[model samples]
Target: MISETMESHKKDSPSDIKCGIITLSDSLKEKGNEGIEEDLSGQYLFERLSEKYEVSAYVLIADESDKLIQAISNMNSKGIDVIFTTGGTGLESRDITIETLVPRFDKVILGFGEEFRRKSFEKLGSGALLSRSTAGIYNKTIIFALPGSPNAVEMGLNLIYPEIGHLVKHARK
Candidate 1:
């Protein structure tokens, strides 16, 4: 019965969902940091999401709360279906992604954070507890806050991509 419901949702879901990728990192925003290479997490997300969804915007910003909030708001106004925010999801003082976005959420997807930590614990042992990755809906836009590491980004995206269509469909309705 559950499978039937899922199949029905999949059939009704839109195929051209638009996604926005934001990488929040103080170092990445530095102008003279020559050693700082490309944003691997954002690139990975773009490549993977582009395979199934439309990537409408991509940007790298500092770890400031105002900047993050503004970016999210701008994307929401642009009618983006989903937004993937990479970086600043850890326990460090500068890791403020979750803190910045939580208040903006209309409905928090608590299961996403729980399952993310559970799966992350399997691969990263106890260190996973330090990660505060989460997902939620804000003004009809689904937002996923992920850790800075490429591995974490891959894991989080892998877990959510399968259900993103359904989530978006429901959120829009």
Candidate 2:
């Protein structure tokens, strides 16, 4: 949760931004939607962001690196300010989300993963380190890759979304 002081800081200048929400999971793509848990988390994030900006697009795809790259390229080409992807960010061999994003990023936001793990550790202890959550900018689009779990998505959304507009605006400049 953002502190009251931080929330107040945003009141003075809030950009009406456009965002993209993507869920990376084989099941989601095969089933044609994120499961109930992922769907709920996505909905929560979308509604929260919509309060401040607009969700321009949403996608659900498998954990394949090529597909992930393609999706990101498509979203960036469409002029989305930010792309938030949930799932496939872990140590597992199949968790290539970060790898796929690396070559595409213009500037990697290293602090996001560090801060997310630090904050999550306050709740889940050392287990937070297992998350491969990361954030970066690619072709002027801010990209965030979060763990597959619903709780992880919630944590990332609550902790990171507040600064998304600022990051995107600065990246464009």
Candidate 3:
């Protein structure tokens, strides 16, 4: 089933999907006027997404629910095809990315989290179970919320980017 689906998607998925990236980390967000430090995960997202899709926006915001929610709204309003967010998917008190976005999901892609953990386990042992990475559709935009670590982001990117257009195609239908 999986192989046949992949073969089918190879020819018909939308190719012009636009993307927006968000990095959610208190430490990475700038305090007041101070310049924010580099966000490696967001950088990696840009470098990779730009290679195939038109990147429409990128923002680094603290792990605050209100702010993150607003960012998602803004991105979706901009007609973005997808939003890839990194960080705030853990047990910490400030980790609210998943909490904020889940309720807004028009359709939750349950397999993403399971597949992420399965893939992560191959590299991170049993610790991968604690990660809450997920993807979902919000209105017309698809959002992929990944962990903050660079390695985790890389794994999530590899697993999702290839199917982004396929995901978008179905969301539109």
The most accurate candidate by lDDT is: 1
lDDT tens digits, residue span 1-173, model 3: 36986878767998988899988877768563241347888889999999999999998888898889888899889889999999999988989999999999999999899999999999889998889999899997999999989999999989997788888888878
Q: List the residue pairs that clash in candidate 2.
A: none
User: Candidate 1: which stretches are off by over 4 Å?
Assistant: 32-37
Ranking by TM-score: 1, 3, 2
Tens digits of per-residue lDDT for model 2, 1-173? 76897666556543867888887777656766436355655666677778888889878778898888888888888889888888788888888898898777889999999999998899899888797788999988899888877787888888876677667657786
lDDT of 3 at 13: 90
Residue pairs in collision within model 1: none
What are the per-residue Cα lDDT tens digits for candidate 1 across 1-173?
Answer: 37887898888988879999989888878853431357889889999999999999988899999999989889889999999999998888998898899988999999999999999999989988887999999999999999989999999988998898989999998
Error of 3 at 13 (Å): 1.3
| Cα error, candidate 3, residue 49 (Å) | 0.4
Clashes (N, CA, C under 3 Å) per candidate: 0, 0, 0
lDDT of 1 at 173: 84
Q: Which ten residues in a row have the lowest lDDT in candidate 1?
A: 28-37
Which candidate number has the best TM-score?
1
Where model 2 places Cα greater than 4 Å from the true spot, the runs are 1-14, 33-38
Listed in order, each prediction's TM-score against the native is 0.94, 0.86, 0.93
